[model samples]
Target chain A: MSEMREATFLILTALADEVRHGYGIVQEVSALSEGRVALLPGTLYAALDRLAAQGLVERDREEVVEGRLRRYYRLAEHGRTALAAESARLRQLSTAADARLRTLRPRSV
Target chain B: MRRLLFFYPRAYRRDRGPEILETLQEYAGTSRTRLAVNLIRHGLRTRLGRPASRTVVVWAALFTVACGLFAAAFGSWVGWQTIRPLHESEAAQVAAELLPTQNLKVDTDEPPAKFVIYGQPLGWYSVRDLLLGDGGEYGQSGVGAGSNGPADHPERDLATLRENLRRGGWEFREYVRPDYGHEVYAGRGDQQLDITFYEYNYGASYISLGMDRPAPALATVGGVLGFLAGAVGGFLLFGWASRRTRSVFVKLLLGFGLFFWWAPIVLAFPQMVEHHLSEWHYSWHPLWEWLGQPALSLPFLLGTGLLVLALAISALARAQVRRADDPVPG
Candidate 1:
């Protein structure tokens, strides 16, 4: 089946806290990822639209500031579920790799 | 960590860009550079797998191809219209009338009715307008004019004109209007050019070419080619700016500043200088001269500007998305 990419994962991660507009989502994702990522408008919109379509995210509300329309998005129940699944998968992979390395390690003399 | 954000495509950056940034600031103590790199690398590879990017690019390419073919075909059709046999005879007959009575000689070797002008050389202005009567310079005067150049100057050297007429393939004619003055018309058929030396009250000389219809096929094709050229050039420059400066903000500013304000302004330089920014020539109409507005003046300027803006914005948005997910260099 289809799965969301890491960028999209980070997008959901940003929204995991609370609702956010376009810029707000970017800010949150950056904070969560430690400035390791950024999003531009085009890419953001494309993902937002796709996630909303797939029932992963929903438009929570709209606000206007400085004469610009900003649409705020929130994670849907489905989005939370997807994020949980991905987190579990990453955790499992990390644990398995750690275990394998420990068993295969060379002991220091 | 701050710089690693450059790895994501622009779309990824815009949606999650701010949050990711804020998160980085909040979690600065961790040595997460390696994780950031891995995330970016994964982000771009995933973005490339996206069907949307391919959809946009392919649609754009198809549109360009359609436009190019349309222009070439319409231009070719107009060319075909000018070379039909009857119009050729008409052109030859008209050319004969422009010659003095003494120079008109019947050619028995050819068709009995066919006559040739066998005398003195004529001045360029006297018969220049009549040569490309239907497919004249005027029709190609719009955006296509840049591509036309002097190759289609109609008034070929006298030797070529004479040789062309002797082959008996095309005809030339003359048009006389009390207001317009002595004119020569030449065409093979539907395609014709009526060439006339127009003298303004100010003593400036001008040449006017009229066409039955403006070729949409040509213009559509030309517009598409123009769009593709603009898109490719625009994307590369913006992408490079993002890389060199390591600033999305800078890239956005430069993209809009150059594409919308600078490029069109640059393209308009020649026309603006020539016209001196005066009122466009076709702005007013005479009371009785039922003839419609002559083509090519202001519409091209505004149309090109609008077209460029639309393409630039689309490309900018796409680039922003691609850059958002891009990985920063080590």
Candidate 2:
């Protein structure tokens, strides 16, 4: 399996709980990353297309409101498993870095 | 902003166009350029994203090249025919007047294939028959290949030839255009001769005589029959194309039919129509003669056909997008 991209990871994480439409995913991903990562519609859709092709996320449904289509996407079981693996990988790396930082602290402190 | 969607291939736009437009409408304000660029890139990606798309592209390219080759071949053939006054009976007769073989130095103890066309001494490479037949021998020197004919026909002056033909009741049918090579045509009593005098290569001017003038009724009937056959062929080809266009093999056949038959149809039909309508000598005119040459005609037709094929593909591609079903089907 390939490593999950940051935006893709966040997007999958956003949909881990429930289904979300394009705008909803963008909003949730932004909030999940604390505004550090904003998902542009173009990048978001491109990744969504790729992820869908990989069977990671699927279109849940589509609805037309105010003459505009809103397509919803949901994380599949495969996507959830992939996300769990990626999160664990990040946690392990962060834990090692934190332990190393502890040693570099000022001795006087 | 929606217009930016046009940058995508038609099929891509069709499949996800509505969804994409809705997204761009709501979110693409400050970053519209980036969004547009990304969409354009993805659109192009999807257009050639599949094996089917690649196949279509390859076939189209092959067809384009085939069109060029067909043009070159047809042009040279037509040019060769034009240089000979085959259509001008009087000219063939003047040539026939010299038949059974012309005066030659008889160099190298090699005798040219001597034949009589309306009694003219017409000498051409023996291999001409072989080339026309199953034989593929190309070792012999080509006719008019190196401009071996005299600066003019050696036996007679242009004036003397013309007067001789006229006195023999032959009428001037064709001549080299001003300052062009000394080519002339004349005919009398169902016989025609075409003469070309090469200035540098003295003592030989290519000459041919023939009695190929069929009755006007026969010619018209032949043209009509040929047109009918062509129409049937065209209809059959169109039917084949309509059946399935995605197959590479089918596309190749379509390409061949379009360039090969399409050219002759475009070229010969108009002349036929005019000939039957006005009952005039439309073909006899010198201006229209070169158009029949294969070298010129083939390329002209193929180039035009390519343009037409491109337009047709573009139209078909656009139409493919409007179905609102699967966008990227083979």
Candidate 3:
């Protein structure tokens, strides 16, 4: 498999724990990325549709909250495995980067 | 938010619109413009469905561009209809005034027809010729006059002609002195005139003049607007049809339609560009001519038929229904 995009990885990570609706996923992704990645409703839905089509996510359930329909989504078996692999790959890269940083002289600034 | 949902396909809007609205509502504090733009962009993408298939986007783009070109041509044609044809008598009078000394013969007294085949108005009789190998014979009608004998004083006549044209309110656009002789282009309002002086080594010089109208500014502006409208409409239609049908036969029909419609344009466009670059055109050949129309009208019609058939089939086909267990309403 190819290396996962930051947004996709974050989305999968967000859904790894509990089933969430569209807005829930957006909030979780933003929180996880330290507000660096603010997933809009449209962007979130597109990504959700793509993930669902790939069988990496599945529709979980629906709720009526404040007179609005909220369709929830959950990570699938394939998504869990893919997320694990991506996490390991990221960890390896981060470890190598940390080692390189330790060898470099500190900036005066 | 509701208006933004309009960008999505009908079936997609039905299935997912409420959920998307709910999500958007939750982020109401966010930039409405950014949110609206996002909805529109993704909504259009959603209309095409098949997120995994990259080729669908390419096909949609091609179909959109073809529709844009065709619409621009049609719009230009509509704009051309506003022009009043220059009468043969008027042309002859102008010719007489320009070359008073020379006994010029008016070879063509053009009929008031937008298009002609073999010097006659386009009609049922010309249909066969228009569709057949003689399609190139179909062309815009114009008045022309030529002189057979050599001018008594070629240089003096040329000078007098230029002065007469200027005094007659004709604006000189281009003047070229070739090895053979001189070619002058002048225009008055929408109408343009081309004068050529061909010098023979044996002293038998021939001078010819032709008058026609250039495409009005309306055509240029209308064509641009039409192109934009056609692009949007074509893409939306293509997306709707693409999502509604998974039939291989429909895809095949679409493929054939694209080939039939786009082949002529692909083949003719480069040649037309070369032609335009090769000469100083007072006005370009009409847009349809560049698309190889009339000559290739049969193939174009066939392509249109195929595309319409494909669209009809897609329209009749049942949209994919969401599973009953799925929470989203159809």
Candidate 4:
């Protein structure tokens, strides 16, 4: 079974909100991951190519800003589903860790 | 950034170059060096038509040739090892002609002839190449070693040896050979026998005999041809396959290639001193030497293997997705 890479997950998460160009998603992903993940242009674009190929995210529109044609991408139905599934999975994992830490935490102190 | 973009396949760049460039400019915190390296790796070669049609060529060729070359080298090493045992058996065969009661003689049956002296086997030493000719034909080597024989009395045994040779259907050179104490020569078909008796010291005599049959070099030639064929075929396949799959595996493979492609640039003295900001006190030579080890090459093999595995995974994932059609199971 093919597991989604963290970068792929982040890319999908970035597109889940609205249509965003390549740079927009890169910045958004960094902010969303809280600087824990910085998407290099190559990595971000490569992930975009893969996701687009997999029918996850797709080209939304193209706009020329500052003489550079920025292509925007938005999540497809599949992309939304996949992102939801992956985010839910991660949430479950974080919740488990949170529960485990709660037991380990000092009680009533 | 533009230069780095060239590391990608031209076709790929043709399709997405403008958009990617725009993204790069718009995207803050982009590492040009890392992106360049990544592009070089992933953009290795362009894919042909589509990803589905392109076969994994380099990985397959690498696997086959690696196995073939190793096997060939090992077989050659082993064949060279057989020279000693062969000489021993040849010596034994020669020894069998003499009465052990009168003189010490050891005999065994081992083909691929060699010369034995005083029961000590002597043949080619440190023989690097072993043709080991095929078609039931074997390679031959002649060796001559001096040993004290017959109580160091060649004068007493010369007449007796001559008589034995005559009886054994060996024709001797009737004339005294040039620059030799005593020499016996006999030939039958392609095989030649030569024995030289010389004085080793005061009242000490040493004798040497060598029998050899030169074998054809067809096997080595065939081996070389086969190796070349495998390499060439693999290269052609790579050229074809690279045109098909524009996957990350291909990109990384070429990115690794960029490391090699610019190796000379990296190693240039001026570039090392100036660009790399390193003092040129010959530290690079040691690094260069260290990197040249056969073990270092294993990383290349490992990296390629990983890429091939990734290629497989990509193909499988796509296949699974296609099989499922619409909705993919989480």
Best TM-score among the predictions, by candidate number:
3
The number of the candidate with the highest DockQ is: 3
Report per-candidate TM-score of chain A alone. Answer: 0.90, 0.92, 0.92, 0.88
Predicted candidate 2 versus true structure: per-residue lDDT over B1-330, tens digit per residue: 677667556776786788877776766444767777666555543443432132333433334343343343333333433232333333333343433234222112112322222233233653243324312222112121122244243445556556666777866554454443566555444333344554333334553222332123333344444445544443333333333334454455456645553464466547756855653221242222223322234444454565456446645654675665656778
Instruction: Kindly indicate the candidate among 1 and 3 with the higher DockQ.
Output: 3
Candidate 1 structure quality by residue, lDDT tens digits, B1-330: 545656566776676555545434433344576447444554543343332342423333333332333233334433433322222343335434332221222221222111112221223452333232311122221100011122233233233444554464545544454674445444443334344544445544333333222223433444455546655554444333323333345434433433333333344445545553442232111100111111222332343355454446655766788899899989
Model 4 bad stretches (over 4 Å): A1-3, B1-7, B26-31, B45-236, B239-330
How well does each candidate superpose onto the true structure, as a TM-score?
0.36, 0.38, 0.71, 0.43
Better of 1 and 2 by lDDT: 2
Least lDDT summed over 10 consecutive residues: which range in candidate 2 chain A? A38-47
Per residue, candidate 2 scores C-alpha lDDT tens digits across A21-100 of: 88888889889999898776556766888888888998899999898888999998889889999999999999999999
Model 3 alpha-carbon drift over 4 Å, by segment:
A1-14, A19-43, A50-72, A76-109, B1-6, B9-41, B49-52, B110-112, B174-179, B216-233, B277-280, B319-330
Residues B1-330, model 3: lDDT tens digits: 799999777987898999998888888679999999878777766668765454776788889999999998888878877777767876788789877777678888656586678988878998888777688787778888889777767778789888888788887754556677888888777778888888878865688888888888887877888799888899879988987888999999999999999988877888999999987676888888899886688889889999999999898774334343458758
DockQ of all predictions against the true structure, Cα-based: 0.03, 0.28, 0.55, 0.30
Across A1-109, the per-residue lDDT of candidate 1 in tens digits comes to: 2565878899998899899877778777788888887665445656786888889999898655554456688999999999999988889999999999999999999
TM-score of chain B of each: 0.26, 0.32, 0.79, 0.30
Candidate 2 ranges beyond 4 A from true positions: B50-330
Name the TM-score of candidate 3: 0.71
> Residue B89, candidate 3: how far off, in angstroms?
0.8
Docking quality of model 2: it rates as acceptable
Ranking by TM-score: 3, 4, 2, 1
